[model samples]
Target: MSNMLSNGISGLNAAQVALSTVSNNIANAGTTGYSRQSVQQVESIAPSNGKYTIGSGVDVVGVQRAYSQYLTGALWSSNSSLQAATTASGLTTTLNSLLSNSGNLQSSLDTFYGGFSSVASSPGSSAARQALLGNASSLATVYNTLGQQLSQQRTQVNSQIGDAVASINTVSQQIATLNGQITVASINGTPNDLLDQRDTLVQQLTGLTGASAVTEGNGSISIYTSAGQTLVSGTQSYALSTKSNPYDPTTTDVVDSAGNDITSQLSGGSLGALINYRDTTLVAAQNQLGQSAVALADSVNQQQAQGLDLNGKQGQAIFSVGSPGVLPSSSNSSGGATVAASVTDVSQLTSSDYVLRYTGAGTGTNGWSLATTGGQSVSLTANADGSLSGAGLTFNTSGTAQVGDSYEIQPTRDAASTLAVSLTDPNGVAAAAALTATATKTNTGTGVAGAVSVTDANNANLLAGAKITFGAGNSYSITDGKGNTTSGTYAAGQPISADGWSLSLSGTPASGDSFSVAANTNGLNDSTNALALAGLADVGILNGGKTSIVQSYANLTTQIGTAGSQANADLTTQTSLYNQALGNQQSLSGVNLNEEAANLVKFQQAYQASAQVISTAQSIFSSLITAIQA
Candidate 1:
């Protein structure tokens, strides 16, 4: 009877606890990050008899939290991928829309180039020249607008990066706090709710920036970034902070708690996406656009310099571009060095930034090394005048450089931002060639001289002009506008050269036949230079002179479009994968109300049955006591 009573009491206790666990599961069924709980049972043993052992009623050992480390890890990985793709996709789309507008660069460029043709039709028309100038101004405005937008995007991205780092730090601190609580709770029993909270925080951390969670022996978790930086370990978490880049303050870099740079190491979440896009894609597009602006302005300015304007003076630059940007490392010694870069060959220029680092005096390679930001080495040539020239730029240093001093030279990154029409007056438009050549009407044998083209606007004898008189053996004598005479041999279809101009003579020229080269004094009727300027629309002027201005813009548009399209596709795939992983994770840990309801019935019945047994034992005890007393 005593053993029966003991068994009944043990069974009732186990059943009550089981019922409580089922009720708890039902109550928290809709809770986020909640895992279903169940009772773990073990048989309570009785002392063995001489001949046989007896069994005891059930004992509730613990409440087990249904969780799987493998499933949860998969979910975190996929979630990180999805977030990164989403961020990149959104930015790429914005860039594509910005550059793909038909009315942006393409339309403005066409209008500007076409204006030259209108001026070529009526060289002396003031209204036509004014319209051409307006077109030029509009072109410059378009370049300025695009450059500003790109720069603004970079600034926006930097701001976002700062926000992400802040978020990661906040979440990390919370997880660390949870870790300390969980480590203590695990000593008594499974800290189910606390573990759920920590895992939730870890997932959020991963979304902002990728992280991996490792379960420690004491029910705590250690978190690491995808780049292997320690984010959280046991009860402690390291904080991340943003700092200005060493060379470019407009750019932001991430640093670890120890003041180490980790900007390049974070490459897995939304934070990584913003940094990568700003540094690589956005800046490259900006540089390419600036390259186009530089090429257009420099080409036009060079041509304008070689011709004569309406006032019969040499043409000045019609466009002005911003100079290259130079930034020295912050760690350099005070007044260490300063570098100014100038574009020397437009065709040889690339859309890349260069880093010029001084390796110390007496070092090989002229004490300095040059490389692109992408890590490709660039060959630098030392000119006789002590200037360094490479990749279409000439770098002149004014101050002494320290051994580790470095300069970031962005050759064309800001050119578009400062592009402007330098020639503001309509009368300043260069409309005529600097000189002209004409054959005398007395020439025989079908000999004729083509139009003369200016070779050097600064030539002292350019306006002096010349007369070429054919002599024996196809030789020619030149009497220049200055009354200076010189002689040279000429062949059919070969040029008769002057001090600043040249003209081709075709067919036979009898001896004593003369052709004259003189300044285009009657400039109003000549449209030679304007026609040449319009022809620039078709001339290859970029990428080693194999791509025209229009084609260069097209390539930039195409690159952005392709990147945007690919980003969207990657985002779609990542979303799908993340969904699948999340489903797998939830299936194992998520609470089911229907299942808990059934458990409620089962445990309730068991409790009642165990109570009946206790009641029976009590009745038997009462009757036995009554019989003994009678």
Candidate 2:
């Protein structure tokens, strides 16, 4: 009977334990990372017949909690991917906005170039030139503004990377601390709510650095990078730092104490995305812009040098000379040269009606005298056959010459060398009785020593049909009377013009050659026109280059998109897996409230019945004692 009562008490205890487990499961169902738990019951054993045993009554076995290692691992993995994708996508969208083709820098360049082209076609119109200049100024402003914006974006990314690293370190430390607490709690068989907190910390760490988690014995977990770098291990966390890349100081990257590219090592995270954008997409765009500038400068200079201007000037440079697109070299001794020319009176020069001449020293045995002492000179002469001599002396041919070099001339042995001259006053009519002069070599040698002089100056005759050729090739040619032909190469003198237009060569023309004329006359020499044209082409070409750069950016963004989608999908799948695992665990561990309540009623009835048995036993014993006493 005592055994029976004891057995009944055990059944009562088991019922209560079941109820507690069910209530606990219901209470924590909504809690994050809380796995539902339940109690297990088993029969107590009683010895019988010395060795054999029989069931006595129910006894509480053990309490189990719901958990699945696989599900938890999946959750951590997905969280990392999700974090990385979000970071990349957000930044790329901003970049795309900045680089968009429509209404962006590219459009600004188009307007600028269009304005220059309009000016080139109408060089005589001041309004057009002014408008072109305005557009050019605006274009420069646009370039500066765009460059600044790009720089700012890079800065922003760098700032974000710093913040992310800090956040990562904080979470890592938290997780490491939690790992210690969880290990102790699990060993003591205490509730592991702190472990759940630690898990949350790990998840947050994954978002920042794409860290993975590994469960250790006794409910402790260690975190590592996807590449297997230890992040958190047994209450110890390694730190991350944001530093400028040694190879490229313009950008920042993640590293440990020792510098290394941990960007690619990070599989998925915001920090990785930011690093990639700065080093690859942003830097390439800047380089492309620089390249476009160079290409524009070079091509325009080449074409402009080949065309003639309004002043009948040929081989004149249109752009500034000597590779204007390159950044100045540090070791260069000479300062950058400036080519400056201005028409004080616009009325005096028209785009189609201007003369360009180099004013410099003359070369040869008897160096020709310059029109102005101590300045460069280009002599102009006329030739017979109605062709002028020395017209070609105005162009540059061999190498680049600076502002103070001279060109010399020698006598030629051809009949075409006789000179003819023509005089034209402001009224724009050729003089009828222009004088012609016969040129004779006073001292002649094989170009090594030659002295030439002009004699028989019938001012009327010489000026009538006499012409001078500046150099070996006729750089300049003037037509003379009815059909008189005369030619003589230029010795030395200022470039004389029938029109009021004059040019100081600053440097010499080649012997027998004229200074190179730049076509598309904007008036400033040294291929300024070519520079303008090249600047226009640069607008188009650079826009194309930028398009390519943006495409690469898009490709990177697309990768982010794919990663983000996959991450989100994984998260969903992980949630499902976790829930299913929890359900299975709950089946073994969770307490059913309704079932527990029913058991409560049954156990109460059993306890009442056992009490009644004890009361009956007591009453029988008391009656027997009384009978014995009587």
Candidate 3:
């Protein structure tokens, strides 16, 4: 009877313990990150004779939380990817809208070119010249505004990166603190709730930094970035920081606690996306814009120099473009070397920053090496003029360069922001060729002189003016502005080149009849150069003749649009995947209220049955004692 009572009490104890575990599950069914707990039941050791043994009541060994490492890891990875795609998509969308807008660079370019067309039609009209100036100003304003906005976007990216770093630090510290508590709790007993909380914190951290968590034997997790940088180990959490880039101070880099840059290795997270955009897309777009601005200004300025403006002087530069920027390396040792950069061919400019590193001194290519950010190296040879010029850029080395000294040359990064029209006067507009071809009154030829045009505008003789005299057989003799003469025989239907000007004589000319080429006294009405300038719109003069000015801008807009579109698509796809991952994780570990309700009722019945057994044991004991008394 005593053995039966003992077994009944043990059964009651085990059933009550199971009932409590079920109640706990039912109570915390709605809890986030909660896993369903199940009781591990085993039979107690039974008292035994030599031949046979009697089993004791059940014992509650442990309560295990339903968890899957694989599912949790999948969820974390998917969330990280989703966050990165979302961030990149948003940034690209904003940039795309700006670039593709009707009121942006394309419109400004059209208006600016239209101004030249107007001047070509009526070069002397004050209204038309003033309108051209207005358009020029508008074009400069557009470039400035675009450059400023791109800079602002970079600033926003920097701010976001800083915020992400702070968030990572906060979550990492929380995880480390929880790691200590979990280790302690594991030593004493199971702390399933704390484990779930720590996992939740780790998931948050992963979303921010794309970090991975490694489960330790003591129930603590150590976190690391995709680059394998240790973020947390045991109770110690290593925090990330941001530092200014040496080449561009406006940009910042992610660094470890020891100040080692780890930005390039970060991927699959919001922070990584922002940094990537700022470094690659944003910089490239800005440089492309600046390239267009520089090319436009240089092309217009060169053509303008070739013609005669209303003031009867040679045309001055219509726009002033910023020069190439050379910045010394921040890590350069004490050196006297100062590098000076200039744009030799704006048409050949590329949207890349070059690094010039000083080697041991020599006269030619041995003195220095040029490398692009993409790791392409060029061995440069010096020009005959003793200047180092290559890759569409010229670098003049002043003073002495230390062997390790380096300079970063940015050819057109700031050109757009610094572009402006320098020609303030309508009369400064170059609208005509410098010299005109005319027939002398004594000429005995039916040939009428065609309009004099500058064949080689950069020729020194074209500036002061030249003269062409007709001879027998439609031939001509040239006398340059410096009084140097060259006589050549000509055909009636063929063209003639004299003193940097080309003209064609169509009719027969008698001997000794003169056709003179001289400076245009009235150039305002001569729209020859204006027409040529207007033709720049249709010419393939930029990107080494691959595209026109407007085409270049169009290409920029198209690229931005394409990039944004791709990012959006990736975001949608990643979001769907993340949802599926989350759902799978939830299905495996989440508590179901209906299931818990059934468990509650079942455990309730179990508790009642155990109670009944206890009651029966007490009744039997009471009867036995009564029997004893009788």
RMSD of 1: 2.6
Worst 10 residues of 2 by lDDT: 410-419
Q: Per-residue lDDT tens digits of candidate 1, residues 561-607?
A: 88899999999999999989988987888777888888888878888
Better structure of 1 and 2 per lDDT: 1
Residues 49-110, candidate 3: write the lDDT tens digits.
Answer: 78998777788888888889999999999989999999999999899866655257777888
Name the lDDT of candidate 2: 0.47
Considering TM-score, where higher is better, how would the candidates rank from best to worst? 1, 3, 2
Ranking by lDDT: 1, 3, 2
Tens digits of per-residue lDDT for model 2, 1-630: 556556656765765676566666667656665655656777787779687765577777677665566666566666566666666666656655555522344455466557546655554455654564465455444444544566778879888988988898888888888877777777656454676677667767776776767777666778877667787888888888877643235456778635555865666666766766665565545433333333333333333333333353332222221111112112223442222222111111111111222333364212222221123443534324322223122222233333333322211101011111121211111101111123224312122211111122112322222233345452555344334543443334544332111222223334443221111223332233433453544333222334332233244345445544654565566556545654554554345656656655665576566556556656766887899999
Which is the leading candidate under lDDT?
1
Lowest lDDT sum, 10 consecutive residues, model 3, at 97-106
Q: What TM-score would each prediction reach against the true structure?
A: 0.93, 0.54, 0.90
lDDT of 2 at 177: 86
lDDT of 1: 0.87
TM-score of model 3 (CA atoms)? 0.90
The candidate that achieves the highest TM-score relative to the unseen native structure = 1
lDDT of 1 at 522: 70
